[model samples]
Target: MAGTVQNREAFLNQIAERLGRPRITKPVERPNWNFRPQDEVLKSATQDELLEVLKEQCKRIHTTIYTTDNSELSSVLNEVVTNYGGGPIVTWKDERFSHWGLDSLMKQEWPNQDIHVYEWDHTKGEENIAKAEQANVGITISEITLAESGTVVLFSDENKGRTVSFLPATYIALIPKSSIVPRMTQAAQKMREIHQNTGHVASCINFITGPSNSADIELNLVVGVHGPVKATYIVINDL
Candidate 1:
């Protein structure tokens, strides 16, 4: 094992030497792009137009979109639970969730249901992961929404585990209208700002356009093979 490690290090050193420099250590600024965003495919759009485009794109990708207000959020989630039927639930432990009264709402509405709230405790991580995997529904907050591709971006931190978005049969995201961006480029810039403020980005940033699907086998489409089979985006206009 030591010899193999030495060989790998020697190979990497040789490659660095051939490049006439060592690996980058400082934060590098990106070079100017040749094309402009407006000149290219994407352009600045009105909020109404973006929402329309996002809705259409989401439908095309087999994602459900529901527009609601803060007062209706509990009902929205309750409706989802009713439609989804009985099963375990996993949700993010975000303060915003409580601020929005989602935690109390869930408890009030789903008193008998098994609801697992994600926390940063490493001791319970394994158990939480298992619960998330077995859960029928997983709900979390969306950091940003890309209107161009109808994608919801999630930065996975301790409060929001990666499995909560991927390991369930159905995933519901609470997306604030203000979080919607014109495209992925803007979303990336927002993520960079987050990294700058936090001193580091989340371990995984997921871009989920729709439910997990593939048409690999003889062009026959399949869903939920690798992740949630169904996804719903609840766009809170008031938030």
Candidate 2:
């Protein structure tokens, strides 16, 4: 076994040495495509206007939104489970959600309903994938995301698995409005900063715009092909 490992290492070193001095190609430059957004791009006439935009987006994709105080995220979560159809809610084993009183809230809300809230821990392997697949709705709080495009960025770290956002039938994201940026580039920059500070590159960074949809098979347009059919972004302004 030791001899085989040594041979593999030596082979890898030889390949690295051979490819070390390869020719460097000139970087291609593209045309500057700076297009100005419309006057109403990110600016809203009022809070109602912003809420209307959120509602419209949710309507376009056949989803629902239930807003609540950011401090009472647990209560909002409970309301979601209680008011909506009963289903499993997946979240990371983070302090934010736990400290927000998730367990007590779940108990209060799902007294009769068979609701399940799974806290993901990587030590247990890929069991959350199956749970998420069967769940009616998957709830998660993003690290940082954008509201302009209604996109949620789920970086692979700790208990915040990518499958929780993608595999479920319905995805409910609680994004603090303060974290919302106007552009995708700004979001990417924030992610880069996170990587630099954490010393861990995200294995999977999902930028989800609304729900999963397609118009391929006979051009009829189908939803829920590769991911959730319905997605709701509950932007909390008070967070």
Candidate 3:
């Protein structure tokens, strides 16, 4: 017992010595030495230039981008639906969507198509998720569009469920021109501001660059293995 106690104490002392002393009389100060300078092009670029940059960036990452006026949004959506051959649709139940008259537009475009709107009610949560998973297309409004990497920031709340964008075969996002930002830093700052002002934030913040892709098995690039295969972003300028 005495030998075991001595060995345990020695082991603990060895660990403590390896870890270094806990208390210090004078603590060392650390300062950030590397600083990322603000992008001059982003800072000085006009709205139109920014839009063009975002479009090019999205294209590079296999994301399709379409720009249109608010009045033509319905027509563009109609075209998208027609191109996709018209199937089941899953949409966020956000009031902003109603304000955009998307419901009426969708009804006008595909009256007979099955449409599921994600609700805040927990009773229908499973159903909504299932619908989203099986839907042909999932549509939602992008909270922020990061131009640098062509990423859309989605705040998953009651309306914007996590799987709504991932599970569907195709993902369509309505990005208001005003939501486009120069960099992800701006988007993160805006999110922090929203949290600071409202004292609440969404449960998940998803940054989607393009459609799901993986080059793991045999190094053959395969898309949509884990999420939506096609990603489309409709940028509404006049909105």
* Candidates ranked, most accurate by TM-score first: 1, 3, 2
lDDT of each: 0.81, 0.67, 0.79
Backbone clashes under 3 angstroms, per model? 0, 0, 0
Off by over 4 Å in 2: 1-22, 25-62, 217-219
Estimate, for each residue in 1-239, the C-alpha lDDT of model 1 and write its tens digit: 22434587678778889999996546899799886754344565767778888899998899989998888888887787668775578887778877777767666557655544443344686887888878888888888999889999998877678888899889899998888888887887888898899888888889988899888859999998989999898998853
Top TM-score: which candidate number? 1
lDDT winner, 1 or 2: 1
Across residues 153-229, which tens digit of lDDT does each residue of candidate 3 receive?
Answer: 89887666888788889988889889988997788789999999999888789998888988976899899998989
Task: Give candidate 1 misplaced runs (Cα > 4 Å).
Answer: 1-12, 18-29, 38-42, 112-122
> How many clashing pairs in candidate 3?
0
lDDT of 2 at 152: 69
- lDDT score of residue 189 within candidate 3: 80
| Alpha carbon lDDT at 105, candidate 2 | 62
Question: Poorest 10 consecutive residues of model 2 by lDDT?
Answer: 36-45
